[model samples]
Target: MEFNPGPPLLQSAPRRSFLKFTGLGLAGVALASAGCHIQKETPSGRLDIGEHDLAVLNYAYALEQLEGAFYEKVVAGFYGGASALEKDLLTDIRNDEIAHREWFSDVLVLKKVPRLQFDFSSINFTDRKSVLTTARTFEDLGVSAYNGAGQLLALSPFLNHAGKIVSVEARHAATIRNLLNFGSFADSDVIDANGLDGARTPAQVMALADKYFVTKISVADLPTH
Candidate 1:
């Protein structure tokens, strides 16, 4: 059955109303003007993500942006064999990603990096296997990115906010995992022997995620610890 993905979300629309609607105003207050640093393209023509907390914020923003775009495309034209449950779940996930993306944008304000362009040409969205695989990858990457970046944040508020967002991302990851393989939500691939989810540094995540982006992101200035 073809799922009506409903009206498309306007990614470019102003975020103030959305913030109010989601009761995220307080969170926005905490993040207001969080990143005031002016970022420039490196000599190699890559966008430098700055240093310290701002760098981590920009990195999360970039990933959220990517996830938002990916989900939009998925809901626009769902893959074959998508069930009613799948459609509903995917739609909810899409909305979640949009909120995550815009929250970072609204809070960062001037400090938010320029929106990066993406290239989803590699995935065949019409194929269920391909779409689910890619979705799983994106969700998994988002969780790991947050887990790894949390330590880099110096501000307690920033860390606290990241914690909240990361928990949502983990839920998305679990849901997608079950969609792909009923009981693989906490499989060995993602879970460590110690029973904790694995984490990846900014550089590691960028290395895996850069292939889908047309705009080259430079994580050189991001903290190693």
Candidate 2:
């Protein structure tokens, strides 16, 4: 995927709209969704990320782990004898994924969030298209996840950080999409008519992401206000 460093689509929104969309002012929706349940920890070895914020953080951590693992595999085999450009681009992306994973891990530690496990059994590592398609889906989902969670964040610093991360994820999404087809980056499916990309709440995102994750996540106790 060729990375295009274009200006973000939401740069021109009115200040109020921008704040609301960026999750600075609105009350966020709770994290509860179908197919997931929350449980309190009993000090067992089993992992338990209690409540909404932790659940969401764990979600992001899981994605970073998946991306990091995928890139590691790609680099290990140097798929199809990747070109110099491919090697450099993939390497940079791998580093970014690693940073993201570590950042989330650090945050979990600071916030007392639980650890997560991933399952990549569905992805075919040997097929380039399969790998890229999965990458596109993951990157796109990560961007949407941050966008949706922005409004839910109570801390200003975290909200701003989410915005920063979302922008980078958008770039990743666009690059992966373009890898599938030239000029397919930021298609209407991702960017709305208002030029702003769409957002998906934690539940909405997890609905899709859960298939790739073996250990289930629960967000039943997350705050809505």
Candidate 3:
């Protein structure tokens, strides 16, 4: 089957969806009155995740968890029967994803974001097309996530780190797309009409991610602007 980079299976959520989904109208109003203060409990049991940092970390952590689980399945299945080149590329991508997953895991462990649980019900591990298509979606989303979250990082180091990851993720996206076709790598669909890639805020990314993740992630504290 030819791989189709269809319109996002899920639509991005606007501000109204956040308020409705999280029931944060009253809390949002309250936070605004208090100079926009929102407190988040971190995984270490001793840290607090304030508005900006916590939200970005949570977003990255969520993506890492998803990618980690996905690559683990891909590598395991390929161990049984996969072509040489496919094996090589998938292995490389899996390693990269593991590195990303570990980076987020360590950061969350330090800040105390609880370990994440994943559900891959939507994926068919036995089918190469399905697996590659899903990988394409995730890699594309990762690039977009970093692009969208770049402005949200208040620290220079974090911003630079995000830039580093985004470049790598864009590479991953292009590779996976090309693997699905001979010349579809980094096509305009992924890049967009402006000659730039797409971006989505935490709320937007989380909304789409929620479909694949069974665990409910609360983004009530994320900022809209």
TM-score of each: 0.85, 0.73, 0.74
1-225 per-residue lDDT for model 3 (tens digits): 111111243125543343334433333343334332223444533223346655676667768778878888888876335679888888888887776666554444334345566778878888888888999999988988888888876655456556767787888888889888978987887787778999987778877787776555665565555
Error of 2 at 135 (Å): 0.5
Rank ordering of all candidates by lDDT, starting from the highest: 1, 3, 2
Give per-candidate clash totals.
0, 1, 4
User: Which residue pairs collide, candidate 3?
Assistant: 42-112, 43-112, 43-113, 44-112
Worst 10 residues of 3 by lDDT: 1-10
Off by more than 4 A, model 2: 1-47, 52-55, 110-115
Q: Cα deviation in Å at residue 54, candidate 2?
A: 4.1
Best by TM-score: 1
lDDT of each: 0.82, 0.65, 0.67
Residue-wise C-alpha lDDT for candidate 2, range 99-135, written one tens digit per residue = 6776566555434334455677887777778777888
C-alpha root-mean-square deviation, each candidate:
5.9, 8.7, 13.0
Show where candidate 1 strays beyond 4 Å.
1-39
TM-score of 3: 0.74
